[model samples]
Target: MNFIKSLDDKVWMTAKARYNASARLNKKHQALTFTISFLSVAQIVLTFCMLVDICFGFPEKVLMFIAMTTSVMILVIANQSALGSLLIESEKLHRFGIKFQSLYEEISLYIKLDKANKSVEEGFQQRYSQLLREADINHLKIDEELVKAERKSFELNPICALWIKFKNLVAIYLSSFLYLAIPLGLLWGASWLK
Candidate 1:
């Protein structure tokens, strides 16, 4: 009875520990997502402002040059943030995968032990059966939960990919817009000089 109870207690403890670890990983993932999102927004805003300045001729040649430089800086920052978020999320997933593998191995050992002692005392038999059932159920539940988590993590991947692509596109588009704006600005300024 005591042995059965100890086994049950250990199973519960392991499940609880895995649950807590997964929750912490999820929170970290959320923080990283938020950071990437915020940086993207800031980058978009800066790009828009720089485009507007180029279109309106607000600060002459010097102002346009400054605007272009600032936009490039924002693009660099956004790219770095996006890359960092991807790497961290991948690390979290790897850790969770390891935990799952370890849990599976431990459960398999317990199952094997239970099978080997099939001719034990009736009380031992009953306790073994009960422990096996509980362990199997708990493992299934954890696996299902992990599946949901993996799905969510997969969803975030494409979003991050799109964001990176969008940032690159914006950078290219704005750079070209500024390239054209520079010569046009010079021509307009030359006319003013005349």
Candidate 2:
């Protein structure tokens, strides 16, 4: 009875550990998403400010240029970080799925062993069978759900790839705009000063 109790406790503990790890991963994902969104917003705001400064002959044109350049760099970095995190998360999930498959195989082997031991206590056999059946059903359901999730992830992969490419292009364009504006602003300022 103690042995069965210990096994049950161990199983529950393992499940709890996995749950915690998954929760932590989810939190990290959310954080990355928030960070990327914030950076994009900041970039847009800074770009607009730079344009306004250029139009109004704002005295702090150099500062505006610096702000715009900095924002663009930050946005690019944030986008790349988000993409890297997503790739890491996908790999982790794939590895976890494989681990679950191994766990299922091990449990199935235990069930088979119990079945072959006819001399085992009747109550123990019955309980073992019930637990095995429940675990099997749960495992199948989780596998099916994971498959669906993986399919969705694959579907989104191309979209994300395109988005990353778009971000890089935008970053390059913004950088060039800032670079060109500096010399133009300097010439304009010089003429105005004269």
Please report the TM-score between candidate 2 and the true structure: 0.38
Question: CA shift at 116, candidate 2, in angstroms?
Answer: 14
Per-residue lDDT of candidate 1, residues 1-194 (tens digit): 45544554444444443454444444434554554455445445645766666434344554445445445544654564454553455455445445445554555566557653434434443644554454422322333333333444435466555564454344324433443344346545655654
Once superposed on the true structure, which residue ranges of model 1 sit more than 4 Å away at CA? 54-194
Clashes of 1: 0
Model 2, which residues run further than 4 Å from truth?
54-194
lDDT of 2 by residue, 137-185 (tens): 1222233333333344336466655664454344324443543455456
- Pairs in clash, predicted candidate 2: none
77: Cα error in model 2, Å: 5.5
